[model samples]
Target chain A: MDTLLSGQLLFAALVSGSLYALIALGLNLVYGTLRLLNIAHGDLVMIGAYTAFWLFTLLSIPPVVSFFVAAALCALLGWAVYEGMFRRLLANPGLAKRVEANSLILFYGISVILQNLTALAFTSSSRGYQYLDTVITWQGVSMTGNRLLSLGVAGGICIAALLFLRFHLFGWELRAVIQRREAAQIVGVNLNRVQPIIICAGFAIAGIAGVLVSMTEQITPFMGFPFTIIAFVVIIIGGLGNIGAGVLAGLSLGLIETYGVALTSPGYRSILIYGLFVAVLLIRPEGIFTKAVRS
Target chain B: MKALDIIFGLALAIGGLLVPLSGDAYLMGLVFQLAMWIALAQSWSMLSSTTGYLSLGHAVFYGIGAYVCVLLTGVVPFGVALAAGAAASAVFAGLIGLPVLRVQGPYFVILTYGLAELVRNVVMRIESALGSFGRMIFMVPSFEVLVWCMVALGILATLGAAAVRHSALGAGLAAIRENEVAAETVGVPVARLKLLAFVASATIPGAVGGLALLRTGYFEPAQAFDPVISFTIVTMALVGGTETVRGPVLGALGFTLLSEALWSSLPQLYMIVLGLTLIAFILFVPRGLSGLADRALGRG
Candidate 1:
């Protein structure tokens, strides 16, 4: 009945969907390459938000620029984590075969560590910044400037990532490593050399996703787990290791979540997200993009 | 050597039960938590380590037991309520496990977690059963009664774990863990056995969680269904050792004492310490304390 309301919801969904897609993409990358779930992806995102928050509040840097700053920081931190934690775990003959289960537990510990440290450094209180908080309205459609900016950054990054994966030489290696580990190895794709870089990039992307969300949202120490859950839902829906489906599913889920909340109370939103997630998981663990999903 | 191991394990277990006789509520409470945690970790170990499927959302059954008994206590005899609650949890797990267990590894993990969160959210909406920060009081028989119940539950948990570890059913679980397809090819009833294990695993945690609620005399969805509880149970089991009853028992008790120390001194830092400990355990001591004990005994 209300076109304006529907339009507003649609826009909001696109923004959220794009953000979720970025997160799913990042998680998918790690899962795809290493055959490990980085449950710490959410914590990395939280840290990115903190990085952006501190950059703006402490040093008076513009929030937009802090996007790259946060990304770079996470990449560095991710590489260190990869070297320190994952490399050792992957090296173990017992754990390497059970990487999926082992990595999940390993990252859970890392998640706990990061969440507690964030609480210690920032305290548990939620923090927000005045970064593009201004609202813009046009012909009955309205959103905060920060929301729009985050959407733009998210879209830009997703597209750039796609293009990079399409054109870059590393893309071929990434695809091979993720899709054809054995063949890739025979073809001289050095998993030892390539995986750490991929993990590092994945961490950076997750940080970028975190910073993007923090722009229009409040930051909290405990926000990591929820975001991690969302990432799980998105990637699962899109099919793990399938970037295209993740993007589409991410956008769709974001829309559904935004519009569902708009239609019902906010409390029921989680129920909707979780219900859909379970349904998809039980029905099709391979994901909606069943055709060549792993590829 | 085997005889010595059994005697050592029994001594430690019996020693643990004797602690509550001291009549210190502080120490008793810690013991109670340790018992509940042991049961939970063992339940998790049953489905996870033996079956090789990491269940990320075990709190669903645990919370079900909490809610079901709380709701049924007055309508039925307290004993009946507790038993019914656990049975209901098993039935529920069996039902969900049918479809969800089809997905393995990360998918299974995510689905289980989602199921728990979903159930908790729905449970919170029941205004009659729980208010915001829901509080309820059922007459706890006695501190000793509570302790004895935990002891009994611990005994039951150990027996169940031992059965799974040593029985032919346990071999099926190991087969599934090694390779489900191969196990199925070898005529292991993968689905049926998994469901059976999933159902059996759900029962004890339900009982443990329900008992914990009755003892607390207060309940809230947030606290009762806390994801952290599942995480804590899993960590305790992992540190003690996975797939063995004694492993979770020792790990749960050891971590409980360690937490009591850390929580009193620095509540904020304790989680970080636990987290770091988990990482360290995964990196250097994957078999946990029980594994270390086994190695020492083997050397000796």
Candidate 2:
């Protein structure tokens, strides 16, 4: 444990964790506020990666610049998804039971559609961009420039999101809805408007994660599903709707994954990660949080 | 109702008989695929529809069954291998259900999903475990034979579904689904009933997975433990209608035919179309075909 706790592993773990946090934050945000699972959340990430990839390849735009553009596009997509799919299911208060059963299928279908569309455009080929192609070493530990860039951006996004939720007026409205929906509305929060904003905001956050991914690792049309699964693991471990705990959980999970792969072969990595995920559920299904903090 | 039942049985038997006599490989292949999906849909319906617990990890049992059959090929008779596969799947379900089943709502859904992924990753580590993408041994069975076997298995599964629909156990599951706390308060023995349903639901998928892999002459991890298969199976059951015997069977048949038609014509865009269809179906027609049929019959 002592030897593995060196700068390199810690840096790697922190980077991976921030990326995971970026993904999980969007997931839990949507879940907490909209009461929808958004199975297509990872597809937002995939689309963001593809968008940045295209911008970089065609317009010579760097991923750093394209990240904002992708995030904005994803926010629009989220708005379309809500207006087209989620609004009606939620409009009726009496349909809550039925909604639970159908929303899963709905989001699943959305994911499949997005994945197919992505494949059609990109031909299912894996792509990556070389941004900040430099390596820096500190005390015999080396870090890729691109990875370090992702790490910095990821941490910035997480902190910014945290602050936005903690102090922003819109964030307060979202929290109110998440904690007590009917009461929040009665207290004069226009749910009709606020809900869509949260949903869009969540998508934008996921888009940022996707662009970050393009800088750090490989991107494929099918990559969205695995990341979605990983995001779910992080949120569950961190506690549903609790961003702080989720970020912490992502960091710990990242550490576990890094050290586990180091100890065993790379193939056993997912096994180790999922084993811990399941163990967490068995031990504390609500996660490590004392209270359910949706924001 | 009895007449409909008899006609359905007669049609199935006649269809099964004609396939062997005609010996058309294409027809045989299509029927085999349809039967495999039907069996899987039926297996998934046993719990998901009745208990309202959407298990996103049902493919683990299917993959396990496939692997088990492949391993026991020379060591045991085909009958023993099939039985062993079913038993193994049920046992695995029992063990997992003890913990995950305690969770409710989305947590239950994702935990089961996680379990399937864990199994898939572990399976990926085994040497030669994922046969060349679906190729089973040559000595397994012909397409016609496999089709007939699947038909027989599917029928048995249907009978099981019918029994569960009318049984006291089914009522208990329904109660649990409606309100777990209330059911428990009313002495419904929620955990035991759920475990039983989970085991029962898992067995046929496991057995049929072995049959599927054996017939296909392969067992790739991606194909065997594919999460999409679970989603598709659930969609079929839902589209046909849940909490009924015929809905899943009809759903399987309808989806198989619809999928084939779409794939043959569109090929490239079929998945997107299917996804759209599923979304539309869930949104506009949540009750599915069986529910439509029930309404036409004016049972309500």
Question: Which numbered prediction scores highest in DockQ against the true structure?
Answer: 1
Off by over 4 Å in 1: A3-5, A292-295, B128-133
* Model 2 lDDT tens row, A38-125: 7888899999999888898899999889888998999999899889988977876544555655676788888999998888877888
DockQ of each: 0.78, 0.69
Question: What lDDT score goes with residue B86 in model 2?
Answer: 85
Over 4 Å off, model 2:
A1-3, A98-101, A291-295, B1-6, B128-136, B264-268, B295-300
For model 1, the local distance difference test gives 0.83
Candidate number achieving the greatest TM-score relative to the actual structure: 1
lDDT for each residue of candidate 2 in B39-137, tens digit (9 for 90 to 100): 788788788888888888888999888878887876788778888888889889988887878987877887888889888877876643444444446
- The DockQ of predicted model 2 stands at 0.69
Q: Is the docking of candidate 2 incorrect, acceptable, medium or high quality?
A: medium
The complex in candidate 1 yields a DockQ of 0.78
